[model samples]
Target: MASTDNALKTASVLAFERKLDPSDGLFHAGNWDGRDDTTAWKPVTLREKSVRGTISNRLKTKDQDPAKLDAAIENPNLQTVDVATLPADADTLRVGFTLRILGGTGRPSACNNAAYQTKLLSTVQGYVDANGFGELGRRYAHNLANARFLWRNRIGAEQVEVRIQHLEKGQPKTSWTFDALQLSLRDFQTPNGVEKDINSLADVITTGLAGKGHVLLQVTAFARIGAGQEVYPSQELILDKATSKKSKTLYDVQGIAGIHSQKLGNALRTIDTWHSEADTLGPIAVEPYGSVTTLGKACRKPTDKLDFYNLLDGWLLKDKAPPPDQQHFVMAILVRGGVFGEAGKD
Candidate 1:
């Protein structure tokens, strides 16, 4: 039997503020008002038309099976032709967003392990301070240059150019140019050959939507097999208008098993932190003016709950390193559901 510890799980909360087309339920970047300044970075929603076209082209070319091709084209969820294609303009879809390392519960952000979290933060900061978000930009560049975002990236994409806006306040905007055809043939490899550069496309899309005021994207990753050493995003749900029953047009794509689209009213409730249950750990909870040695079952305040970092610190103090599965679990709970920033909310 597979151990529960090995199960892959992840929790993420991506909030965005942007304008949406009431008629088509499409995202519009130019209409962003920038009302919320809560997070350090914001995401610009890319046109669904572009996303659809890109996906469709890739699918048709790569999959030789006629039935699968038809399914890809006919399925409303997978079909990109329904939306009108717009000309690329000044409002290009920029790829970049600030990824928070701490979850609402002070756990590792995105359910990443302590080691991964430490490396990501330190590496990103080092690059940002020295060269100004260049490493991130390169990753974005590699994605666009290789058309790795396409649903069928292995096949290749036609001429494509992606413009990445700098996350830093004063840095200049830059464009990463690449020929999809050339990138397809190039045998690019990361320092560690275990993972490919193109694999980051999923991360790029999930993070890019952080600022799109309309949609709330929550991703969860957990071990599905073995000792749960490797975690992968098992669920990526989109809370949008198409899935809402109140809307006149229902864009339900049942074939795409896990993509959830719900009305804004229902979606907001998923991440509502105001009325969340307190998740606590440790033998005795810390309380104000409480006796620590008393047997009256000490409890820690919700705000005082230990996050992933703190939990890791506690584990380190014991001279015992957390196993991979435990690390993933700790991080998952931190982001499971609840507002991290609000005091006593989780």
Candidate 2:
């Protein structure tokens, strides 16, 4: 029989997701692409078009005027494409990623058993580091792991969060297994650099956007099945939400409709409704290549009592539903006049 706790088995599966499109491509995105001519690093920029591709054509100066020779020689240097100078509309791109751990060969452990688990995690890190993951970049150790042991590196575009947990309850005498492993990159760092934490990655995104006034997201998903059929990718999703909540809130409070709190409030309310309905009416089949359509309230503020007009307080994850608490889950809060956007709203 499947225990009530059987669902928790899947909890151990970690899923990480992020958006991976920077408004520009020529500059730094998330992690370094290891492609720069100056430092064995060439920035990973999504190339939509190119004027030249062949070396034979590149050296074809046969019909040039002598006066134009110097200019043409310099033309190769001038042939560079400046992604930074691209139009603002170019920021519209996003990506998605997913990683999962099917059951391990051995038994598993409890989530609270931090001591022994740490050592086991280190062993895994050493394995990954010794055996590089190619373009997936290097593995990094996380907090629960020995803070330095290292897990694999990945990039995601948007519309997701990273989750990790134990595959089961009792301490396993031999081994442990994970169910899901996924990450969502908030910005395009490098398609191949390591980010130790979600916070650090988020910081990179917020900083880049603040300076460039735009951002892009790219997502990649690695799926492994059987022996060979194990890699696939998805189209990018662009985040068009211009202007930070901070800037918009300021103008909004000042009667500037563009930055109005009412709009923010409305957005939150919408999120709340949509989320609530999905939870109640779902087993929403949110699978790959499947439409992720849902109707729910936006991010909202919960009230003292159950007020229909007020914002929703939180959400309920089928996996994280409480035990004896009997209370509804609270997702996020909307401050009456709280900090809307300093950074990391997600």
Candidate 3:
């Protein structure tokens, strides 16, 4: 490596905003047949339920004695929790959100080092020219069409349908409907019949990333489970668990049960099959460290030179182009976006 190149350092004020912006998913309940007419659907509301409960949790040795166990069982563990359920007449759960795919991906939101930023942007442009955004765009579109953003709500659904509309102003310009259950979460293979539609959707996303045009999409997913069945919404992270009155707090937007945009984004970007453990673990979300918080382990690590910093620096600073997969990983980190500046030295 050249001395000049070795001397170059990462920007101390580097940051990037997420290119794929999504709004919070608002939940609604309606009959499966009424999916075409969502105007009549009702917003899923939270209901408070109290349960007598039982003492099933692990107890200390002292509390395991026969008399003590009997006494504890008598008291039991009573609690009040918030739950969301589809109305008895409504057999479908509708999740709606708008996604805006912004351009200027490679450009940093903040970068102090002009020289380094220039090289980085140039490298990203080179990638765009050679590969285009087709691969990543296709995967993202697939996630949408598959209704992966529905998360737990899609599980055991009798039928899942996804409708995506290209919005111009307040109206839809073009629309696509998908039988979400036909798509697989494990791979990005074009499902036999939906190939053309997936490709069309992928092209729009690619165009958005390439700065060809602005892309705004309205997405609606219908999951037909059963009437009066429990529907899963995003849970609020209670910082003070002990002091909190309700054990389970469902997320709400003005009294209407909803899912977090972060959770939806996480589901959509679960396209990191480039990591080493992907074959076994399936596709985790595209994160800088390839982190899957639910799994409690990072798929990529700096020690292994598989992390974003290592691969990115190798490409831009070291003048060593990474493999296509690794390149995709680096670009994905940019799409995910973060404040990635190197910390200042003392």
Assess every candidate by TM-score.
Answer: 0.25, 0.19, 0.95
Per-residue lDDT for 178 in model 1? 31
* Candidate rank order under lDDT: 3, 1, 2
Question: In candidate 2, residue 87 scores what lDDT?
Answer: 24
RMSD (CA, Å), each prediction: 19.7, 22.6, 2.0
Give all candidates' CA lDDT scores.
0.28, 0.23, 0.92
Who is ahead in TM-score, 2 or 3? 3
Local error of candidate 3 at residue 161 (angstroms) = 0.3
What total of clashing residue pairs does each candidate reach?
A: 18, 70, 0
Error of 3 at 120 (Å): 0.8
RMSD of 2: 22.6
lDDT of 1 at 59: 57
Report the lDDT tens digits of candidate 1 across residue range 1-346: 2337643222233121221111111211211122122242222222222122223445545638888777667765424212211123212211222222111223223432444344434433442244432232233334334433322212322233322322234443322223344443223333343134334432342233222222222211110111111111112333685864331221222321111222321111111111112222211111121113435532323254333334343343333435433343333232233332212336
lDDT of 2 by residue, 1-346 (tens): 2457422222232222211211111121122121122333222232322344323245556877877766655543212221211123221111121111111211123333343334334432443345322211111111111111011112222221122221123322122111113321111122223344433433333333223223222312111221211111111233453532211111111211111223212221221222333445421211111123444432222333222122111111122222111111111121111211112235
TM-score between model 2 and native = 0.19
Off by over 4 Å in 3: 1-6, 59-74
lDDT of candidate 2 vs native? Answer: 0.23
Best by lDDT: 3
Q: Give the TM-score of candidate 1.
A: 0.25
